[model samples]
Target: MISMQIRRLTMLLFVFVFAGCASQKSIVADKRLEEKIDQNFSDAAAQYKGMMRRLPADRFPKTYYAQTDKFQTGASSDWCSGFYPGTLLYLYEQTKDQSLLLESERILKVLEKEKNNKTTHDLGFMMYCSFGNAERIQPKPAFKDILLTSARSLASRFNPKVGCIKSWDKVKSYHGGEWSYPVIIDNMMNLELLFYASKVTGDSSFRNMAISHARKTAQNHVRPDYSSYHVVNYDPETGAVKSRETHQGFSDNSTWSRGEAWGIYGFTMVYRESGEKSFLKTAEGMADFFLAHLPKDTIPDWDFNVNQSGYTPQWKYDPSKFAEIPKDASAAAVAASALIELSQYTNKKQSKKYLKAAEDILWALSSPKYKAATGENGNFILKHSTGSVPAYSEIDVPLTYADYYFVEAMKRYKELKK
Candidate 1:
């Protein structure tokens, strides 16, 4: 009887171990996931159609305030202008909707002039997202020239002394251009354009600039715990650090959620391009930090400083704001898209972990709690995205980039599942 009991106990233990291993390998999903993705794509088509009808001849949609029923638009020079056409291209790619294509082409015409506009550091956001996707889908020679010009324009912002791309010429809060040679965390997101330029033209200059920027950013912008500051101002002439501040976060020391998300996407892309283990490690660290902070719903607050101590607020400290801190679905969407790419560069176990986290976020954002109803939300897809809480801009609104990354994540998730 003792021998028989031992055999049964051993068999049960083996079964339990096998089950645990199997579950770890599996991504979080269900029958409803695909249905949710498809429904989102369909809703995107109709929503964008409504946006195009109202989009000014030379303007791009930025955000929509549902409470005020306001649709904010900006010129092609606006940093967010590329996201408008980019989101439309993504929708067109998924749905093959000709209207989305037409609108993207029309918007691209307005945005194309920025290829030669060298005054701003947002050329990548304004040109690449608009024309890069165009080149991928259509592959025209004109698109190549446009992208090359945009890349050159972007590379112009790189200062060898600083070993980073200058993020802004003017940051009034930081005394722009005088004491502030601002290098923002978001600038890392622009390196893909440079890498593309180097690939097409066989120009090591562009690639070198991107590598330098990534390396310097990894050194200065990223924190020890893998979280990041929003902006780092450097002395352009002396190549010395000035100050690190979070202009749009609650505190200067706080990890603004979107800025952190940018770091994850940027480092992941850098690793993919350079195949350097250091970049991969950096990306993984950033991803891990982001994953650790996610709430039960898989979304995050505008800044990770809400409840944490040791944070010094730029404004008056207010405990009440933490009671119901606004959530940033945009940041969650961006991280989801980035984590999918980051997963490809990790080991089997870590890859599964990253992909599962991404899956959970995608699942939550696709639900009705975050996604807006079709034809509502000023025709934007996801709702409850916070742009900059400290700046008091686009708070709790539908952002164009939020929709862009969400759709990109859906496409990536579906492809990975297949």
Candidate 2:
């Protein structure tokens, strides 16, 4: 790990240099919508504070089902462990609530041990979301140490032969088939941690691994339309492509909304970090593809091809139930946050298009259609996120990460307007 002083300097340099250059002067803010966004943040502050009060000491919030009034908790090892604290940090950043900060700090101490966890590739989702934001807001030597260690742990999952990070080791009977050396599109999101490792430690190994992984995913995981497959199994021994499948989407060929969102965000971030024109173009293609597929309300179904003619779901749903298919606000939240950053990397015309798409999403999320009531949703802010539809789990629920990225997008929106 690099020294904390050097790491801090590196982070500062990255923020100044790679942060996008979209001109926000022409970006006009809608007063009524702005007020609504403010209220959403304010409500999120209270909702999370109330949640922290009721939360178990050792558990992290995952998803909440309002219909059943069931608030679910996951262990510290769960991929979602970071979003609770991450959301708290965002709320605290906007509201300056001591309660939020104290809660976030409390969770971070428990979550710090995962810095050494090597079993999962979600350290970015689990560590960077919490510790990354923590370091940004309240930089500390300990935070730096934790982040670097987490980066190392995440790097351990990369198999050089595969040219990508392994998403799941092997799984049998998972979503109707077996997977070996699977490299899901979601894995692209984890590359940010590797980039951070290289930037601070000045180690090209981490950067090279990240570049290789990004290139491989951009080449294989995308369809002709730039829509992403949920999973792409690879040959670990020869670095050859085996098959592409979907674990969470409607079908193997269908586009899972969150998976596509991850690619868009990941490529945009990779572009920012590496200054690779190819990654930027890839991100722009992905953003355009995702935007072109949005529903009338700008939210996305759990999978984009759920009802398309050529795509059939792995699980059978009644034909009458087609209209009731759950939408994924989590996907929207993630994509909106990414689009805000992606906007900075483009020309004025394309920037406006990306920003407009993001604005539409943010506006919809702030409305009653997707935003939860102030104190409802078990103190969770947004509702209607589909976690894993094929698993029949957390469908149409309020997810912690959804709340994390919603506020994150709102924060970016506020800053962009300023």
Candidate 3:
């Protein structure tokens, strides 16, 4: 009996030890994952250095396409203008390189005029991305003033009649009709700037506007499956939704990948700012819809609702041929960054799942299949990001925003590891 009891105790000890090992294994960083993250940052630094050498000192890079590896420049008013400096700040944060900081400051000086410009709804992209990151890294009173001014400029676009910020000043509808007031899902991202402004200035107006816009978007822009419409037109008189359509997606009914990414990122940000459970639930739902439809490699095609059975790259114009569609690395990067932040705010089970999904995407993007080698892909970090498939714009190219979010995601991942 004594021998039997001793044997039973030994068996129990073995089981407990094995279980503990398994649990620890699940949380520990894999050697391969660590190597991939390090390599990605190293490659990114090299690529940005090459970009700095190639790009004209006066212009900001927008995108790169085709076999020639040519860099495209955009105006200061362009929605993507902030990404150039924002990306530089991200790199500077990692490397502490003074040259990168100087370059970003030069660009920021040029972008300062947009703080008062009211022609567009992209002040967040233009001001916050640049100035916000600047303040985070090196605080300056001037950056805060610029950010506050930008928030006021953005607030001017908010029409109480529509209950949402107007996206386009003018709309030329493809359906041969005029849209009175248009709100795109992408506008959800701009609310971050307002939330920040409210916090710093002790102004409830900015916060109220952000909450109202979010609630309105949550009511109309999101579908039952958590997919988002690209644009929702509202009546200027009654604040009623007039029509739902997609200008940059496969069709009016299809789900645009970048738009969906914007929803996920925006809602996740909303939850962060407000600590609202509803916002968290909304973000999780959209994240689930996005993850459920991802390709095997974890990156998404330009439009998730597109029928792959009889689709082609030329189908947008030809309508008769089958062509392979391109993946949107920009969307993947944005989603990955959002998921990393979302993981931090959730319970343990969900935190693990979200973090794992983000890690998978980062690993996939780090692979040669998507990560551009140094001096390649027009000196961009990642390749094959689709901007707008239906509009035939920036299709299958390297975009500046892709690099920005990729760097941001890697930064967030590193912080979590620490």
Candidate 4:
């Protein structure tokens, strides 16, 4: 009887040991899957230092075209003008590098003039990304004033009749006419600047305008499947949607990858700033759509609605031409950052899923496939980002915004890990 009892004890111990080993193995596997966020941050800072050295101190980088091995510069009034200084500020935040901070301040001087420029709908991208970040890092009264002025300038573009801010100064209408006022999905991102302006000034007008724009966009821009249209034309006099079409996607019904990312990021940000449950729900739905459509590697094609087997313009109706379409790393970066934010506002189960998805994308971006070699990719940190493929512009390049959001996502990841 004693020998039998000893045998039973030994079998129980063996079972417990086996289970513990299995659990340990699972933890190891999970850790391997986790992204090395801090390592990526270090890598990004080093690459940005190189980029700063390569770029002319007076100019701002917009994109790096791999085919030409050339870096493109944008004018001060260009929508992308803020990304350079914005990136510098992001890098400065991570590294606390004095030179980057000084360069960012100097770049701000060049962009400061746009505070009152009302012609473009991109003041948020032009000013907020740069000065907003600066204001967050270091409380500067001048930066606050510039942001307030920029918000008012952006507000000036909002037409009461259209219930949305004008995205483009001019756009060819779907009927081959002209649209005096048009709103794009991309416009959703500019609302944060207005929201911030309202908070700083205790002005309800800016907040009201932002809420109205968000409501209108939430109603019109998102489709049934959560895919967003690129452009929505509104009758400037009547406040009616004149036409819903796409200028940058494969077709009116097709999903442009970057446009989808913009919608996801924009709505997620709106929910963060406003605490509106509706906005959160809208963002969640869009996130689901985006996750479902992502390619096997988490990177997405420039336009999800295009035929993968061949390239063809839906409008011109040309014969299918066989070629591989480029992926948009910018879209992936934007979605990754958006997902990180979204995870914070979701249930535990969803939070885990969203964070895991973000980790996967960030890992892919940091990998050799997307992360450019030192001193290569025109000194940019990322590669293979597509910008306006339909417009035949900046295809298969490293975009400034891609690097900006990638850095932002990594920062957010670090914050979450802590």
| TM-score per model over all chains | 0.93, 0.91, 0.93, 0.91
Clashes of each: 0, 0, 1, 0
- Model 3 lDDT, residue 163, Cα: 80
Off by over 4 Å in 3: 1-17, 20-31, 308-322
Worst 10 residues of 3 by lDDT: 313-322
TM-score of 2: 0.91
The digit string of per-residue lDDT tens for model 4 on 1-418 reads 9999999999999999999999898567446534465566666777777777877766788887767667788778889989888888888887788888988888889889999999999999989999999999998899999999999999999888878889887667545877767899999889999999999999988988888898899899899889888888888999998778888888787889999999988999999988899999889888889999998899999888786554345455332432577799999999999999999998888888898899889888978999987778887889999887655778788999999888888888777766
Worst 10 residues of 2 by lDDT: 19-28
Task: Report the C-alpha lDDT of model 3 over 1-418, residue by residue, as the tens digit.
Answer: 9999999999999999999998788666455677677777777877887888887766789889757756798888889989989999998888777888888998899888989988888898888899999998999999999999999999999999778888898876667566789899989889999999999999999988988898889889898889888889999889999898887777777788888989989999999998889888889889888998899999999899676554333224543332677689999999999999989988898888889999999999998988988888888999989987666778889999999999999989988888
All candidates: CA RMSD (Å): 2.6, 11.4, 2.5, 3.5
lDDT (tens digit, per residue) of candidate 2 on 1-418: 4699899999998876655332332324555557878888898998998898879999999988767777899999999999999999999998998989999999999898999999898999999989999999999988988999998898898899988888876564345557778888988888888888888899999999999999999999987789888888888899888888878888888889999999999999999999999999999998998999899999999888887899876665555744588999999999999999999889899998998888889999988878877678888888899998777788888998899889999999888877
Model 4: lDDT to the true structure? 0.85
Off by over 4 Å in 1: 1-31, 174-179, 316-323
Error of 2 at 413 (Å): 1.3
Candidate 2 Cα errors over 4 Å, as ranges: 1-29, 173-177, 315-323
Give the winner by TM-score: 2 or 3.
3
lDDT of 1 by residue, 1-418 (tens): 9999999999999999999887765533444687778888998888889888888899988899877789999888889999999989989999999989998998899888899877777777787778999999999999999999999998888889998888877665533344368888998989999999999999999999999999999999899999998888898998898888877887778888999999999999999999989999999999999999888998999888875879877655456654478999999999999999889889999898999898899899988899988789988899999987766678888999999899999988878778
Clashing pairs in 1: none
